[model samples]
Target: MSAGTSQETPATARGGLFVTFEGIDGSGKSTQCRMLADTLRARGLDVVLTREPGGSDGAEEIRRLVLEGDPDRWSAETELLLFTAARRDHLERRILPALAAGQVVVCDRFADSTRMYQGLSRGDLRASVDQLHRLMIGHEPDLTILIDMDPAKGLARAKGRQGSEERFEDFGLDLQQRMRAGFLALAQEFANRFRVIDGDRPMDVVAQDVLDVVAAALPERDGDAGA
Candidate 1:
């Protein structure tokens, strides 16, 4: 993490910078999250790289329950509650503490994900998602990086992964298309905190754009990570 002081945001009261990545399935947000963390760590900054739905031990358990079952296994409402619960645990156990300790927190997905997946895709529960978020997880990331991709391409990449967490991908390409649109709408809804980047490019190209957006959001770093 860059030892250079990060800007304070109303969304994050703690000292650390809170960055989140969001996109349709297989948009490479997870890979980018890891790359960003690695880059920051190499610079000597204190960083905490984590993911939603499975960041904390408890959340990980819920992740399997929601992600491994059949697509019709749970109603949209039930899934929303489960995801919110997992997010709450993740926030309290991992995010809050890391921020309080003044470490940069880079999360692969956050509430905006719930806003897209549960709120828009599965059903018209965007209002409920916001209500639960305000009631349970009142915080938001300081910066949100939205990776925009062609839904079909993203779905193909997602299915190609052959991972156990295939519940969402099983929803098929139509759902992926809707989700891509929903995410773009969300980026507009929270324009100030969001930075949308085209994800159809090479990994290095996408990563460079992500880094540039992040750098614009943060203060210039002059000190070493250990400083």
Candidate 2:
């Protein structure tokens, strides 16, 4: 599936919801996504756990290129195109199919990250990338959990865990600060669909807050207790 192609299906056919986690490094997105997926599964809901820049085979290939490839080799346009390409494959193969099967799709990051990282970070390319998002993934998440945290604190946590930084992580404080601002702006823009969670809190507290938000967004599933 190419980025521009639309895989149209009836609204009724889309039986499940798509929820994405957005935040800077070490903001607990991965952990929260997993916890949420597990909770949903325990409630007898079919759930899919996935991540951006890598989900399907093609996307994973692109992920390697984007994350580990020569930094000087790719332009902003090249980066955006590769990311979108991966997203197209992911949606056609993983996301859409899972949602159609009535499974909740919990993704670590999605279009919002692109908007913040590639789009806003590059400034001039922001408009074009946003256009690509509209062209490619026309659907937005039913709910977005923005794990808000201080970039420095998050970076320290990430460094402690990984022992090293990737190319993106190596961009230093300025870029991370800008990306944080970008995420905040996006959250404001999509207030109805976005919930900002303080990631500075304890892990259990953050998890409980996330669950509360998810439960509120999906009130219909409240009666379904966890297994």
Name the runs in model 1 displaced over 4 angstroms: 1-12, 219-227
Candidate 2 residue runs with Cα over 4 Å from true position: 1-13, 163-165, 219-227
lDDT of each candidate versus the true structure: 0.85, 0.79
Per-candidate clashes, comma-separated:
3, 0
Give TM-scores for every candidate, taking all chains together and pairing residue i with residue i: 0.92, 0.89
Candidate 1 residue lDDT tens string, 122-183: 99998888878777887888899999999999999999999999999999999999999988
lDDT of 2 by residue, 1-227 (tens): 43223343322247777889999877888899999888878877778999988889999988888877344557777888989999999999999898787777899999888887788885567777767877886777788999998999877776567632266776667777888888998898777678999999988899888988877765365434432
What lDDT score goes with residue 139 in model 1? 82
| Collision pairs in model 1 | 1-40, 1-45, 44-225
